[model samples]
Target chain A: MKLLTYFFQWLMSLLWVVALQAQAQPTQPYSYPPSEVVRIHSKILNEERKVYVHCPKVDSADGNKRFPVVYVLDGDNHFELLAQYIDYLSRPDVLAIPKIIVIGISNTKRTRDLTPTNSLLNYEGKPDSSSYQGSGGNEHFLQFMATELMPMIDKNYKTAPYKIFAGHSFGGLSSLNCLLTHPDLFDAYIAVSPSLWWDKEYLLKMTDEKLKHGSALNKMLFFSDGNEGGRNSFFHKSLVKLEATLAKKKLKRLDYRYKHYPTETHMTEPVVAYFDALRFIFKDWEKQR
Target chain B: MKLLTYFFQWLMSLLWVVALQAQAQPTQPYSYPPSEVVRIHSKILNEERKVYVHCPKVDSADGNKRFPVVYVLDGDNHFELLAQYIDYLSRPDVLAIPKIIVIGISNTKRTRDLTPTNSLLNYEGKPDSSSYQGSGGNEHFLQFMATELMPMIDKNYKTAPYKIFAGHSFGGLSSLNCLLTHPDLFDAYIAVSPSLWWDKEYLLKMTDEKLKHGSALNKMLFFSDGNEGGRNSFFHKSLVKLEATLAKKKLKRLDYRYKHYPTETHMTEPVVAYFDALRFIFKDWEKQR
Candidate 1:
């Protein structure tokens, strides 16, 4: 019985080796392309943050090419999606968008970094202390991005000058805050259903006050909202006000578009909204090509 | 000199052990949850296939719940994109789509398996033997999917009855072919920019012949064409003909919609088309919920 057990164990080990060999051999059906997860320490945020970077297939043709970077907020939620989009849209045959690097900044404290002002007001104009704790860190977050994260990414990867900042909901508010305060940080901005009701529409007031009439801003902005409370809701009203504010400014070289998706929800809007935002920002890119 | 060499070797082995230990330990800066690459052998196609599966964050709330499967063709091109989309759209809060299993079938002789008929005709009605060499294996490919791939998937993964068949270009042609021939294979079919010019508009004829007037087919079909050519092109004509044929049939239970994206190219269409297709197919689903 002891001899039989030893023989069976040996046969099992042999089968394991055979299976490993089979896995190593390249078959037409099975190809495991390597995708790595990178982690870096951020001094400004005082926390070691992780960013998911999905680079394009680097063949001989694209050896020395530099890619534009897309820094997406809510990294854990939308990083993979944006990475996949960049990979597919930048294929040689499908050159709608350029090959781009995606830097997804995952969150530790959601309310601490993405909000502009640390207020306890909820969407309904009521005080919600628990939800709004540690808010108003948008400026600090942007500083961390510009000073710490961006520098680290630039030092590590092949990147271009053109950058895009994207976010949704609270992240959406962060995107707009960056656009308003640090317009030079990104070439384009995408805010899907931004929490404009934050601190009683603070961002809207800032947008109205920031731009001088007929100023040459030279930036691209894409913002949209979904059916938060049907067509005639306060969420839609705030979006309308923002659009009106932008229209009133008539800033030169400031390319902007506002889209309304009545059929999509606040959460579901990001998927279509982000795609449209890309399309809107790059509407003239294909024409130039 | 012999003692120094032994010390150097010992130091190297210690460093290797530390590196391996670092990789195994999930630390704060290195919290990379490794994704799995699953491979299954197909008996009918006589080929082994690989699938990249990223399941949701498995917590105590959802322990043994099964997921719906989304089988996308042209896996090499669009698997990661669909995987990311599925991940984002099926989040706990998002819940636009259900938690689903994604089976991306990578191409093996794409022209052979995606084209409908054995013909050497190009888009302009001219004979293009070089391009059409290994055409007309779609039926056999579908058989491989049904008899081999589907069973293997069912046996291995936790799958629900609901399945989606998606494809682009020639793969789109295969998707439509599967819909007409084997309607029971998938609940929803998405054909983005299908090669309608294949074998003298073979699938168009098949659509006209197979679907009876006022018949209850009980299927959902979403087909669209981007700007393959300008407005007065054969690609657009074929899509128009398909719509007309479907309209003439007047199938009571068949829910279908044809979308024309004049702004998008053959390559750029899928990004937006797929999103629109999903929304259209599930437009009423949300209301029901």
Candidate 2:
């Protein structure tokens, strides 16, 4: 009887230790979430660019799945924002949008690569020669993306043909410029308060000339401006004109939306703009999926 | 004549090489943009938390100056979004708000900490026993934040007393719960589509009893709901009840606002909600500053 009692006490103590271990070790850090950074060499730009890539938590069931890619310019500025949105929106519970691969392209040269025309003009149309000296190399930048960057990204990652090009300010101009010059590069374009006034409203004029009259240009475009001035401001006027130009063309299969954020500033526009852009681009996608 | 020509050619070639080197270097990778990750050990949760912190490009002109901190919940979700906004909005050109530090708190046990009550009831008022078995620990969670999390954050990072607590969904519920229970913890509270239906409107009952009628709370609360179940859904009804409760009280010094987004869904609300929440919270801050 004494031996049996001692053995029972030992068994109870062993169970307590096991219970404590289970309580303390809730979950392993590896099981939490995973995010990675990928680097690609761009021969057009002649530089090795680092991209912050955040993918959804892949389950074992869906091992061999491809995802739509959102290539956001100014990776340093908005990579994390896009990553967060994609993560939350594509959660198993949310199911607002499908899981996506967010590739944030950090900027190397803002003025040189993102602007449409080479000009020394600043926001006020004044020659800020020092700041704007190396402007208007966006075409080369797009070439870099088309021939070198995208191919490298495609070769490395599990990417679907469907891609999104997004940017803000000068970056925004680059996004629109890419769409106009190389429309096949991406499925959708998001220009958040694009600098249309760059090089004497070069892209704004280009928009009017690019689209064929009443012809099909199957793409989704979302453009917006925050309160750069008021509703009557040049910033607002430019976006309105872009909208009006698209409306006049009435191009078949061209889906576009222009939003005016009276409350947000030019700087704060991307936060809301990117969100709306994603929603706009994927509006039909959700229904179809 | 041959000697002189050869010397001139050598000089020109040297000058050409120097110019090429100057242009190719790429402006020292813009050293002013200092964004880095800081890992700190948290005693509260007993884990090392990796916080992605972004400070304003610290101007050498402003020596040893500190800025206000915005403690964003769901750090993994909205840290980058808020960081980008702060960086852009506080630019010399934009100047909408002062440069602020963003502290993104990544989650460990999100459901355990963020939810207010320990109930098995899901959103549909159905018991999901396995999913919510360890629920209703938000009070203890808040205590952990007050005693352990905040101090650790304040100690490691350059923080000011002026703090803002921002969250969405379960995080949103936690934010409101913090406001109601520990009003002194954060100066402003932002709850974007908070789970007020948690534990059969546990927070709704607590809000009425905690906040005295016509009393000075001296706090800022921003709450909003998207098209959760249309306008007449239980989610919408709870928010309306919350608004009505506060209205009936007429609490002095409690600056609050409720926004409704009919176009946005529960998943997509945070994008627009956060933007509007920041605008509302800081509406008077600009004038005051």
Candidate 3:
């Protein structure tokens, strides 16, 4: 009986020591791709805007090197995802793309700033005044990006001349809008599931008007759609029309690709589309290197 | 001159205020999915092990709910990526998959812990002594996982009975090895580019011997190969053989998928294969609900 009690006591002490060691072992937060939030007061918008900036970890030898930037809209939704892709693709082992900076712009007035024309029509072609109350500010938004945001980013960071604009849904519409209105603002454009039905296809008509046949518009573009409604849906039809229009124009140096994901839904489409878009943009990049 | 001086002073004051405001605007680290590192002393492996744990954010309504677990090998390389995918896929907005816990097992001894046999020959059939010094301790490692790690996770976190084992490359070989040797260890297995050429195709032969024709092995498996070598390469050929063997077996209730990504390299394959595997495993999930 005495031996049994002694064995029990020994076991208890061992358990206590093991527990203490487990607690004492050093642990740290799972560090993700290093990213930061920067705040800037925008004069054009008359509001404070916050953006998430993710830059690749620089080598000591390449501290002064500049990197191309990808300005992503819907920052709150897709910044970290883009950041993760950028980091992984540009890793030492996987040199699929060059190390680039990702600037994610968060929204204060998403609808107002993303829509090209003021209209209250919902996706079902019905009036939705509550959701579309303060629309048609995308032009001003572009001006702010071109003049204020771009200049600020260039001045503060080691930025290269090359830049890419990326967005999804309404944000995607804005990206295409920027390409048409302010072509020199970015070198590449990604519009995933863009709301081409916005204001009765305002951006689609704008694309036709702005991009001329045989015009020397050197840029890369990737646009895609998932199963928002299906093949006959306005979403899919608009994408097909956009593709056809671009092909008909045969504009010089406008490299573009359109992908359709039938299995994915609208919200889950960006997860795959963004990765594909990045791969498309950088497809020729590895060969050039 | 007096008016100019006054205007200059006003402009200077405004600039100073703007600078101060920029400095004062609250900035915080980009918050990632909350994750933690756990240290465990494994008596089976006779060493300490570190695992990464990433759980979905618990809603107030789901305080007592349990989650399925995915145990991923190569914690250092792919944990963050999988965590990101799970968080995005299981979001309230994007209900592509259910919320689950991810356990990433970090490697202490890579070759010994991951390989199934003691072999000095690499993919090229060349003897590499240093690299294969301590090969073939995977059985003990799996024991550590089943006896030590899973129990600890179950005791600490709200875990469901459904479990998945995921790995890549050599880790992928171990995943297949576990499936063939200890079929009841996990409900699902994901082997992304398993090095089937290991020990002159030991696991491939083991699969032939262990799994009987039309056997009732109720499990899900996803395996794939990327551009490790071209289509005619041994890597691709071995995958073809494995698929043929499985097909010939006609194992009952063993849901399996084989994907080939010709565009992606061996290293880059995991990025796409994992997403596809998750989708495949949960393909019928929505309809069941």
Q: Judged by TM-score, which candidate is best? A: 3
Alpha carbon lDDT at A215, candidate 3? 98
Residues A69-143, candidate 3: write the lDDT tens digits: 999999999998899888888888888999999999999999999999999999877899899999999999998
Q: Candidate 3 residues B1-289, lDDT tens each?
A: 5655675688899999999987785565677777998888999988889999998899997878899999999998888888889898988888888898999999999999999888998887788897899999999898998899999999888999999999999989999999998889899999999999888888889999998999999999999999887999989999999999999999999999999999888887898889888888888874575
Rate residue B204 of model 2 by lDDT. 96
Q: Spell out the clash pairs found in candidate 2.
A: B117-B136, B118-B135, B118-B136
After TM-score superposition, the amount by which residue B215's alpha carbon in candidate 3 deviates from its true location, in angstroms, is 0.8
Candidate 2 per-residue lDDT over residues B1-289, each given as its tens digit: 5655675688899999999997764323222234455555666657776666666677886577777888788887777667766776677765667778887778777888788777999888999998887877788777777887678667765677888899988999999999988899999999999999998998999999998889998989999999998999999999999999999999998999999999888877877787787778778876686
Model 3 misplacement above 4 A: A1-27, B1-27
* Candidate number with the higher TM-score (1 or 2): 1
lDDT assessment of candidate 3: 0.91
Q: How far is candidate 1 from the true structure (C-alpha RMSD, Å)?
A: 4.6
User: RMSD in angstroms, all models?
Assistant: 4.6, 13.6, 9.8
- The sequence of per-residue lDDT tens digits that candidate 1 reaches over residues A48-155 is 787767666777988799988888998888776676677777788888887788888888888999999989999989999888888999999899999988987898
Model 3 lDDT at residue B276 = 87
Q: Give the share of true interchain contacts found in each model.
A: 0.38, 0.24, 0.59
The candidate, 1 or 2, that scores higher on lDDT is 1
The sequence of per-residue lDDT tens digits that candidate 2 reaches over residues A133-247 is 8888999988988888778678777888899999999988999999899999998999999988887788888989988889897989999999898988777888899999999
Interface RMSD of every predicted model, in angstroms: 8.0, 17.7, 14.0
Q: Which stretches of candidate 2 lie over 4 Å from their true place?
A: A1-57, A121-131, B1-137, B155-157, B199-202, B286-289
Tell me the tens digit of each residue's lDDT in model 1 across B1-289.
Answer: 5655675688899999999998875432323322355666767667776665544555677778887787888887777667667667767788777667887887768898888889999999899989889789899899988988788778777888988899999988999999999999999899998999898899999998887788887878899999888889999999999899998888887798899999888988888888877777777765676
Candidate 2 docking quality: incorrect, acceptable, medium or high: incorrect
Q: Would you estimate the TM-scores of all the predictions?
A: 0.88, 0.76, 0.90
